[model samples]
Target: MTEADFLQLPDLAARSLGGAVVYANDEFFASRENLISPGAPDFDPSEFGHKGKVYDGWETRRRREPGHDFAVVRLGVPGVVEGVVIDTAWFTGNYPPYASVDGVNLEGYPTYQELLDAAWEPVLDRVALKGDAANAFVVDDDRPWTHLRLNIFPDGGVARFRVHGHARPDPAFLTGTIDLAALENGGDVVACSNRFYSSPRNIIGLGRSRHMGEGWENARRRDGGNDYVVIRLAGQGCVDHVEIDTSYFVGNAPGSARLSGIPNGDAMSDEPSWVELVPRTALLPDCRHRFRVDSPTPVEFVRLDVYPDGGIARLRVNGRLI
Candidate 1:
């Protein structure tokens, strides 16, 4: 996939996604926790800390010695990394000249010292970086990794770090009824009619959206049709029930919606033959709507159609793996 497409993948390192900055060799100038903060990095020229000019990124004291600085991050969704964005926004003067990343697979809970002693394999070799830029790199590895180590050459600040990749949730925990379209469950919104205002992926986020911006939203549709999104399930399953939440979407909720499922796990996504899961139903603004699926056929993909669309806070495809 292209860099922009890779960006659509889940940020496995986002703090909101349950990731953590477990350890850092040094964060003398700034705290290490800022690395995986949600949203874009911000800057206030007048902001300053005691030791020196305050930075919004992880920073270490200028190296008088001969080693680089690094931080270990535990991924929220362990999976194969497709790419990374080392955002050095607002760190023009003190940004790192070079950086690299390493990955390792671990299970259960391991202490910081144990992670430090674990075997590390390179995910992205040393790459050149630009100050105040979002340096992107595509990793070609296919193995699922649970943790990552980001290394900055010598010493400098890096505003943010994003590990973009598909989620590979532990299959052992995916048994019985579950949200088949949840990002943490290995499902993804692969296609959509429009995502002008916000991403459709948010419709299946970790939990209920706190506001309208946290949900899937489309621009006002002028012509005839409507807006919709196609979600690929974690696996082939029989969808038993569904939840459509428009909470916090007071004025922009879709007037109505339809749900359908595709049994073709390997067939093309655009196949015309789709089994009806739920017929067109009226939806209330800022309310949670639930429906029972009468279909019995197993499906790997499902499509949700919103009539003359607006916003959808969350979608739950609770079902059993077949």
Candidate 2:
């Protein structure tokens, strides 16, 4: 699949885009506390609310609805929606068999299986759509969905569901045709370098380019006499390790660079996983620099947080840019 097919604005990104509250359930609408609204444009519907809404005794079971049941959310803009991720922290209601999108009416049965069985029906526009049953979101093939309807079989209490997928121009009759043919005929597979982040900011590294804001500066150390060179990771990731290279510059024979954790919630855990620095050696008092993470865990992103007791220059990753 092309990058457009695999990475056209992930489901999480779509949910982040600010928009109007197209629709909500009348039975149990989420409190305005954390819900994103026109007035509070920056608010995230999933987190940080004044007062949380509560549902009664339904906590013991999940609700499942079967007929004419579903939640529909309409996006503000018409773009290639790639995927959807539903943060159902409150999905104590029911479990849905599946969800479907209805941009066009079915001439035969009301369900997807029936549409496949109707031989007399005209071919429908096959839009890209995907659903994350576990996460409670529906991702679609790149297509424009002005109105999205989620059909949930009546089960019980489902907190939230999201749809994912990007809106693309009509699937060309000739576009994926060539690629599809190549796959059938036998073609070499290709791999891509994925980008990620680490640390508290969850900084994302766009790529090895200047587009990612990068700069270096020298800072005086608390030790009083030495300074250190610092390079911040574009963004944090599940940083298992970091390899730094400082061979190009001369007159920089440093001892070591202390790895520090930036506290963002539990990131700076007092537990052993707090920060693992490789090459367990003292910071070079004065010299060049290079290092890596001793042992690390998955991180949203990380800053190349450094502490240089002495002045130095140049920093680069040692292994894959995980």
lDDT of each: 0.91, 0.32
Q: Pick the TM-score winner.
A: 1
What tens-digit string does per-residue lDDT give for candidate 2 at 1-322? 3434543332322233322223333333343112222111222335642334343211112334434343334443334444443333444323333334443222222343443332321112222222222342233354454444433334233334333343321233223112110111111112111112111111111112121112122333455353322223322333333434333222333345544333232433355234444433554422334454544443322223343422222233332223
TM-score on alpha carbons, each prediction: 0.97, 0.32
- The best candidate by lDDT is 1
Q: Which regions of candidate 1 deviate over 4 angstroms? A: 266-270
Q: Mind giving the per-residue lDDT tens digits that candidate 1 earns over 3-33?
A: 9889888899988678999999999998899
